[model samples]
Target: FFFVACETHRARAMQDRYVLVLVGVIIITFLTFHQEICKAPFMPHLTDPEPPPLPPMLMQSKRQLLPDMDAEAPPATDVPSPTDPAPQLPPDPPPTGALLPLGPSLLLYKPTTAPMWDPTFVPRWQHLVSIPIMRSRHSMRLLDLCITSILYMTPYPKFDVLIMLDPPSRALIRKSFLEGRLEALNAQYLMVPDPIYVDDFYTGKYWWVDWPMLTQYKKVLYIDNDVLINADLNDMFDAYDMEGGGHIYAAQEGEFWRMWKSTPMFGLTWYKKTDYDRMNAKGIQSFNAGILMFVPDQIFVTNILEMRKWMLKWMEREIPHFTDQSFVNHWFNTRLLSKSILHKIQLFPEHRSYPGKILLHWCASFGTPASVKYDKMSSYLTTFIEPRLPKRYASRDAMVAGLLRPQMVIAEVGCFTGNFSQVLLETQPKELHLIDWFKGQGSGSDADGGTVVKLPGDQALQMLQDRFASSPQVNIHRNNSLHALAALQDRSLDAVYLDGDRGYDWLMQDMLLASAKVKPGGWIMGHDFYTYDRVTNKKAEKSLNPDVEKTVNAFLQASGLKIYAVGLDKQTSFAIRLMHPVFWFK
Candidate 1:
């Protein structure tokens, strides 16, 4: 046993020495070979073992020099140590024939001058979202000096006007915005410190003509707010020549001969007289920048930025009457024409000053004196445009609509002329009782004869009877509402609406009976649930009856029923039975 143990210890020590020698050899070898192993560079994996030698199709003929494919092999430049970053090279060009968009599609607005408006009295119109519709004495041209122009522009649903505001103007317009004068127009706010061209020569007037790059719509339709499209512009979208890499869509300012000058600043008759003559002989017209559909290229954006620079250089020379428009004329007619390219600016001929065209360019209509009546334009808007605008429900109408349910019994008290009752009947309810005596003495003064007091009771009933004759659901009771409800069974009604005479006794009498007649889970409501204060008097231009408000409050307070304002104007108020947990919690 002692001899075996001694042999085992000696063998173990020998094995340990052999392992250490083997490890030392491996360490030395790895140190020598590590650099070469990592020297294999990273390249994007493609199926091909080598990159294709041919240049991209677009680059083949146009580009003067193409990047060498062989140079794509990983360079054996300075070997990066552990702490060193990988060597940087210019990024690989986009894949062959891969077209990248210039930028996102956007709608832009520039409010250079504030509009003249009274925001509060303006009605909330659902058709015109996010557009300020305050009572404006200023012509649309003045209001559209920035953002207001879009109010009468194309009725495109996707038009959420991107109002480009400098930081300082935001605060000044904050109140008008909060008041929701612009809610109908769908206004979006963007803060630009200033325009791209901040030079003195570029007045804020038509600078928004460059809205394409400013709002970042690679392809854009820039219509001045004053210009309204008589037809949908969707058909016109495909009409644009997007296949051509460079294109500009605009109307000719006037005849090229009329705008031509001895210098390049005009229609470039002097700078590129030969090219102008050539295109002119081919029948191309000089164009306007006002209404345009164009792709914003680096070429155009560069031209815009260089306008100030170029003008400064040529200041010892002439400046044209129209600033940005002339610059754009020079860009297409001269710059692109000289390159033997198709000048690509397809001007809309026979359509420029053609009033009967798709676009109704109420040309040069802005900033005119208020006394200068646009009676013809008003007729056009009223007859052609206003009739075409989408009709929307008023807040009061929508409130009445929400409460109505089919297969329910309801009563409308003091339903003179049944104007509001029309909204309720839309639900096709099982039965609706309309109550009004249709007889009240009129003092001839508007204060007493306001609406119901002067209405002929017998004729009003005839109208209601005829209006609802097709609807078997409506039942008219030509009597005072209080006496009318006595005939109705207790807990028989699902809802009761009291919009009767404004006298305290009349309102209270009707409300008390309506509350009792409505089922335990039913709705009880009234219209004009507001005090006749100075605000109301001033708005109505006469004294309003306060009895409607007083009677409603008293009845609801005494009955311990919580009333909810149904419309934004607080003209309608309603309360349901105290059965729902929502009412209890409130």
Candidate 2:
């Protein structure tokens, strides 16, 4: 009975122990499930990531509001339905000053604000003139001056210049006169065949024999390179077209029949001594072939095809001094006799002949040395021609003279009336480029505080050309400032003066381009840098440009450059010196 009682006790004890173990296991499982699934607020776990640290206060986007569920819904048409696609807004524009990546390592900043230059712009020209350039240096110089005079003084802008030359002469002109590029002069070249070598004058004059070959043009005016056209030649051309019926009209030689007296007439089988007597008695004389208006088609029947044959067969030899003048005079005289007319055929009236009432011809071969004639021409250009034109404004140019030194390569980007350019010239720069669109200006305050009258662009252009035409150092570019600035080679200028477009973008572009073009240690300068009031930074009376100061400061800051100097003139000017090599932003 005692053993059975003990076994019963042991079994009961074992069951109680199993029940405790089962209860403990159930509690552990409940805790694990609660922690994993419920994640209670009060319960902390090792795996739970700390709530993401609050975002930066300023960077955090505003919280979008959810529609209130309890609020009364608006009319269906008032708001878009929840299922409808969201409205789209345009993406914002990219920043203006974003750095343009140059390469893997380098980045540059170029302005995207300014309008790019038009690369396709070309002036359409109408009138054309043929200017014959000789192989000699003296003649080339004369040609240059002649071109300058015609461009500046003619008062007409439609004329296109054509250079008549042979291969050797063309090469010579290209090397010496054109600096190895014919396009520099903006002229076309016409090749002459088997050019005559003359000691006295250029053989280009003889090209009249081949005028018929120039089938492209109906009428052509021939002017010597030594002549400076002071007035319009259109009237002369018009007169010839109206009065000269398929014939030539020319200025008479200074000495009338005396020039043709020694010519051989015996070679003309159809001519008689009486014809010569009648011609001399009637005051009939050969015209100076230097300047002629001729119909190219009229001479097609006479010696037009064979160049060498005409010279050998018809040339008068009694006066051994041979020239195109003698040949044309002899040839045309015979043509005139066939038509039974003497003075009426070729001679222009006395008013247009000899002393040249309209234009000046420096008959260089007539007893004067070519060098002497050139000097005289230069003197006449500066002293006589320049003084005759009006000075549009009071002098503000003297102030800039102090900034420039002799023989510097200088460019004035916006020269008006050449007032500042005159001072630049006085400094004797090796080359001075005067650039302007010459698009006219309204009445404005002058340097002396007087109101100047309105000026037209054409008149302004004419004035600028007249004022500077005599100066070999002055080169005028009638173009947009952007176009002109871009045409310059980078790092080629010693200094660039900007008084061009005053708009913020334009000023910035000009400054940037000028900075790029200037050599290291060179200056970039501009006008109207400050207001007349000098303080308040506002556009004061007489201060035409309000954006100059801001644009200049911005450019200086960007380029890491500083203002070197400022002018003391009433209309203030500023200058920047580039100390180091510039790596211009894109």
Candidate 3:
């Protein structure tokens, strides 16, 4: 019975062993399959949604989820939207052109190639930019004398006048003119503190004007109050013709240049701060404060201030010959390297005047009365003297004689007197448009006293009314010709006459505007064609027969308007118009 029991136990142990072996084999097989599946490369399942939720069948089968540790997932195939921020692009290269170095030290050369021509060219070649280095003592008499000389001598009607005055001289009046005359000329004035010459340095009460003038005009022909200008300055503007150059063109000391060619005073010298320093070190040149054109940049201004301080410190040491003038000449000689720029320096020849083309400088030695009485001075003053007042064109006689014909509308510009309108009235024109600035009242009034109707609150309207109050038939417009022309309807007038301000720019502006108002083939006439030489004072030797030559030439060149007839009245030359030529008028 014991043998049989032991055999039964052995049998039971064998059965248990068999079952354990079988289970181990099955587990190994499942793990091997899972390892194989995880190691396999993945193919994108584009058609499936949510990646099949991690395979529930594998979890139920008791398989390992990831047996292999080496493989990577495939990269994404779809790109991001273009609207997303992109990487920055590289910058473009710079353009290729000729380059130039700038500063006062460098001498610039004009290029051989011709400069592009500009129609509105003013000769700035010889133009002098003056800066007055004023001391405390204001020189009002000198200032007046210089200003009067400028006014009398300048040939051009307009100038950019800069007056740097001391703060104290703000209320002082430089010009003695009637109230009406002052308004006619548009002049700009400014006042600032003088840096070089302070108020406490000198007790001369007259120094206030000098300080003011120096402070106001940065780039000017700073004339000492005692000096006089007696030449036409148009040549000065010609200096701008130089292709490439620097600032501070000056006149040479003729006497000095004649003595020594290689000497520092060979010609007018231009010096900046560096040049000034070099000159002081080498003892070459000095500064001149007399009639000069100052190039007013920050560097130059600072240098000027420094130079002024140096001068004051050495005032006791240096025996003053010409005061600042000799110093200036010395400064130019020491600093300026190349004498090529000095080619423009024109000296006052012994027989000929200094600034023969532009100005005459009458120093203090001449005395005020003698200076004023000089032949050049007399001639200068006579140029601006107004001629005898012109006689009025008789309105009734003109109309009766068929000099004036009835038209759809009569347009008269620059109606100094309403004589033309008066003539138009006799012909009973349907409309009369009179345009003028009317500088003089009653100067252009007609016999009938029917001129422009002045309206209140109209800036332009008031001007026309004040000037043309005598002419009842004429309707006055105070606005600029360009503005008036823009307001008019097409073919609004039958006849148009223009005689406003005399300037190429002004004439052109008026002509462009008037062309729009006149009907096709309508009459257009102008005045002052024959008065150029008379107006410019260029007719001393030549006869004053500029009526057709000057004005008509300019008018034709400007507007291509043909001259129909030259009506020879007693004093005035009147131009009648032909039909607007198709080729030329436009």
Candidate 4:
């Protein structure tokens, strides 16, 4: 037994000696290769010397780079170590995207002059998701689909969209669709500086356009134009905010070799063994730049100047096949390592089922030629997306034009100064009756049980008469809405529009009377119907006549009639096709 114990102790000593020898070999090998490893691209000098002074052009630039920040201080060259505590940030500003107080330590890069693209692009939100549009026939087509999808798919609390337009495209889009479609969609625009070319080729320089917007917005979600929105991006936006705003969030590019060139994994190029090893050690992985979410705060704002220097460096070095995507992956490599997985929006080709994906990115890596992409996007929109989107009319006049048919009898109860009467007549209604007390709206009398006091309609009546006097189909009536609706035979008129007094009981009576007069298959439409937040179903605070919605809803319950359609306009319009027999309880 004692002999066996001695043998065991000797074996343990041998095992310890073996470990010591192995450690010595590793240390010697590392010392011999230290210089070569340090020379690798990924072994970035942690203590890099301060960059040279700003170039003449950058110095003389119109935008004063770092507002209220330390002029002597250099931009952050490295990400805060994971063990380091988070830099204390000021309390969150209101969600309205109001500007934070400019403290001496807070570096902000705001434009001194107005935005070159569009002066009207006043950002009122904390987060803005921007899409860049270049001048071309194909691009214009893409813009239509992109904007349409965003406006349609996004619910009530929609994300603010900034359409970054090059100068040439701005003129063409403004002339063609901006006035009618884009404007109605409430999409904003910014005229970006002209196309920037690197080595006589456009290398996606437009991506930088969003960098400046961070000054105005707390966060910016940069989306490529070719990227089609399949579902609401609200979840993605919320996820970004929840993670805190300092990091860049993007999906990993499936193939690492596409972004980095190193030994073993990526075939040998300029990148050395140590470069790849260091990147792996730091947890850095390349990500697709198609969709990126980043905060525009002091950290990023201060680094704007450093980014410019890096651009120059990459250009002069003549890096092999360098592009904006490659630059972005390296520039934000630190944050890339810990990029939130929640930001991995499903990519295309890999996933064809559109039901679950937030965005369907037709990435350039797919090698789809521009012409082919055009056809595919158009076909996809027409087949799957467009059909699902709700039908939207730009104006009340447009809605009326689509609904009314030629030779149909129509009456507008509050046709003040014949604004809508003109619209009704344009439809070539068989007989258009214009009714108004035209004294504008009257005040409700509390003493008379909320009865609206009718006023004289002399001037307005005369003006309406002069405007529609030449039209043979027009008939003007100067009377209260109740009397005007009552005089008509029951179930006789094709359609009647109630736009008079918005008082609760008065509107209820007007709706009841109009319902009885319209034919079973005809319409009873009204103006000033309140708009509601689509998500919350709460009446919008800005709704002028809140009582109109109350009255319309009350009438629907009592009469068993449902609201057929609601018009998207400042003063909301609604229609109710009289589909069933009229039944009034009392």
Candidate 4: worst-modelled 10 consecutive residues by lDDT: 101-110
Q: Candidates 1 and 3: which is better by TM-score? A: 1
Q: Each candidate: what lDDT?
A: 0.47, 0.53, 0.40, 0.58
Q: Candidate 1 overall Cα lDDT vs. reference?
A: 0.47
lDDT of 2 by residue, 437-465 (tens): 87756232444334655678788888889
Model 1 CA deviation exceeding 4 Å by range: 1-156, 165-183, 190-218, 233-246, 262-269, 281-283, 311-320, 337-358, 365-379, 389-586
Reference-based TM-score of each model: 0.36, 0.43, 0.36, 0.48
**In model 3, which runs have C-alpha deviations exceeding 4 angstroms?**
1-159, 166-175, 178-220, 226-234, 240-247, 254-289, 316-321, 337-356, 364-586
**Candidate 4 Cα RMSD (Å):** 22.8
| lDDT tens digits by residue: candidate 1, 206-257 | 3333343242443555554334445444334544454223456566555567
Which ten residues in a row are the worst by lDDT in model 2? 40-49
lDDT tens string, model 3, 264-350? 322222233444455445534222234555444444444454444333322322222233553445433543421223232333312
User: How are the candidates ranked when ordered by TM-score, highest leading?
Assistant: 4, 2, 1, 3
Global CA lDDT of candidate 3, please?
Answer: 0.40
Tens-digit lDDT track of model 4 for 42-153: 2111112422232343433232432433223222222222334443333333443222212222111222233454444566567777777665546666776676566445
By TM-score, the best candidate is: 4
Residue 370's lDDT in candidate 3: 35
lDDT of 3 at 564: 36
